[model samples]
Target: MSTRAMLFACWIVTFGMVAATVACAPAPVPVDERRPDPGTVVGSPRRLASYPALYTSTSRAERVEYSSRGPAGEPTVVSGALLVPRGEPPPDGWPIVSYAHAGDGGDPACAPSLSPDLRGALDELLGLVSRGYVVVATDYQRSSARGPHPYLDVASSSANLVDAARAAVASVPGASNRWFAVGVSQGGHAAWAANERATDSELRLLGSVSLAPQLDMTDVATDAARGSLSPERVVLFPTLVDGASSTDPSVVPDNLYRGTLSRRTDAAAPCLGDSGAVGTDDARAVPAADYAPATDEDRVRLTAALDARRLPRSPATAPALVAFGGRDSVTSPERTRAAVRAACARGDRVTVLERPDDDHRVGISPEVLDWITALRSGATPRPTCGPEPTSPTSTGPE
Candidate 1:
């Protein structure tokens, strides 16, 4: 089918998921605080026959299933895609990029490779493939793995990202030894975690690029505590709690889900699908005061969980390209700045850029490819260890 027809079909699928609410809550699940063995390897990679709907003609997409630890730290099979361009590789091999998808709802069918592209992800992948780069995209453990999807578990997602990179090397030919990471929103946080976690890994992470990453949890809990969260944001608050509660028993969202809020959550699907979160008319009417943590204990738990999953205060081993949208409403520019400030305080090597006109979805400038190219060529990557820069500097090769 034509691209327009294909997109139309995808749109139909997405709109249907907009206001879907599942009955699931994180506090009652049987699993929580379970830690992975970290060294456990349970399965080998297996390839699927069909590619996703948006798999472009420029590259061949291979759907592969591999094992990864779940949010509650259980091991299970997870699925992903490895796209190898159809041409000769550079002398060493194609440089690898692990692309993490943003929130697509907490459902099995939400895996990027299993459905049509969202947010022009296919176009981005096509650009990388056309440039002879190998793109290894993870469906994350929850979307295709054997458990309820892990919405925001940092440890689990980061581990899967590193594993996904390793899986690329093992499952595809002409995959290079060099690896770089690029993530947006939730994926940006994942990229940050991988940045810290991969310091001791077998696969090398040369650097990372995070676009409008969700940085501070203190801010999140504080916002909720003050009931200042917007209606649109209130919709995602449970997801934040649910993800934390799944892995940390202390993080309970039940206290807040007492009445009408519970009904709103019950009606909304996890991941909110590719259409993103849609606030109900009721949800839109919710005052900020109604969005607070149930008790001091839950508030403290949210604080701890946020602290545990936040970006590294110490410098990551590799260089980083950090970007934020000046006008972003979701992962606000201020939060991104705070994270970058903390990173700078620790003497981490990072380059800050701002898309003054873009929102969260269009953060980091399109020159992210340029950032990657600059890193690969070893011409850029300056440290922001001293006084904090007054503002973001747009980054692209000269």
Candidate 2:
């Protein structure tokens, strides 16, 4: 055969083999484009409970269930509460505050909406409502979404907060389009993330306030494993495992914890308070060596899953007020400063409030309240990124 014809025949044979291989390959799964957009409300806010005379400023209290994005970006129902003020709103409408509460464990009943005290933030919520702002607090997807709660997952909490803001404004009379994201501890992380995530929605996020935000869960876990965590902070270990497993199923409880924690029965219960409710009584008093990861692979799996959930995933859409206390060992000041520096480097306008003398309880300070007041009054806040000025100002381990 001619050289050209021989080459052509060889080419045809190679092409046929390639075609056969391609045909035999498994079909790729199609992306589900029909998933509802993040923050899309799935249903009307069902009345869970009400407090008519809870606070003088709040004419009424409405706790309800709404819809938000789950950890996997799927639409799911969640719970929240609204504190509407007594008086008439301004011509524009009453400003909104999307309040993210600190961590309350991974159990469904740990939801703030179910608590009569609003998860110990009643005074704070009442104070906000007194200022003529309608407050909206999310119970997070852990309360209603399928699967384990992604404890520190920023995306899930951000979506929940933004969607709660949307749902609250729609459900409550005289609520304005303008709003601020405010949170403490885990909620603080959510507020910081919502500042970035809210840009996707039509909500006008005036600013964000993150108090002692748990920015680096990987570091927290590392500390816990090294026996360096405080006794008060040790309770967070199970929630971290649950959170990692939720985001990445390969990092399950059995893959990480030992003894009582390896089993789901005890580990699945509420874990935040001093109640002997988390795991077993022995689990609470056990050495870090007992509850820490079983193997290096398990540790690596947990680290990767938690690291992916850290904050400042992107520059925020609006200015942020970051408050941290120097003596706060739970959510250490060093980690918070590092997160602020990273955020500033990424073009986020962050204002820092540092109180060297205080500990983790420095959140909801007078200065932070004043900062919110100034922002509500249309004043542009200057970024506090450089050397933090030594002054007198943080939350939960989350």
List the lowest-lDDT window of 10 residues for candidate 1: 1-10
- Tens digits of lDDT, candidate 1, 253-332: 67644444554344243335334334544566776556678787777778787777677655677778787779877776
Candidate with the greatest TM-score versus the true structure: 2
- Per-residue CA lDDT of model 2 for 17-123, tens digit only, reads 12321111111112245654544444454332323336445766766666677776766766677788898888889989999988776455566765556678878
* Candidate 2, pairs of clashing residues: 355-393, 362-394, 363-394
Task: Give the 10-residue window scoring lowest on summed lDDT in candidate 2.
Answer: 1-10
Q: Model 1 scores what on Cα lDDT?
A: 0.63
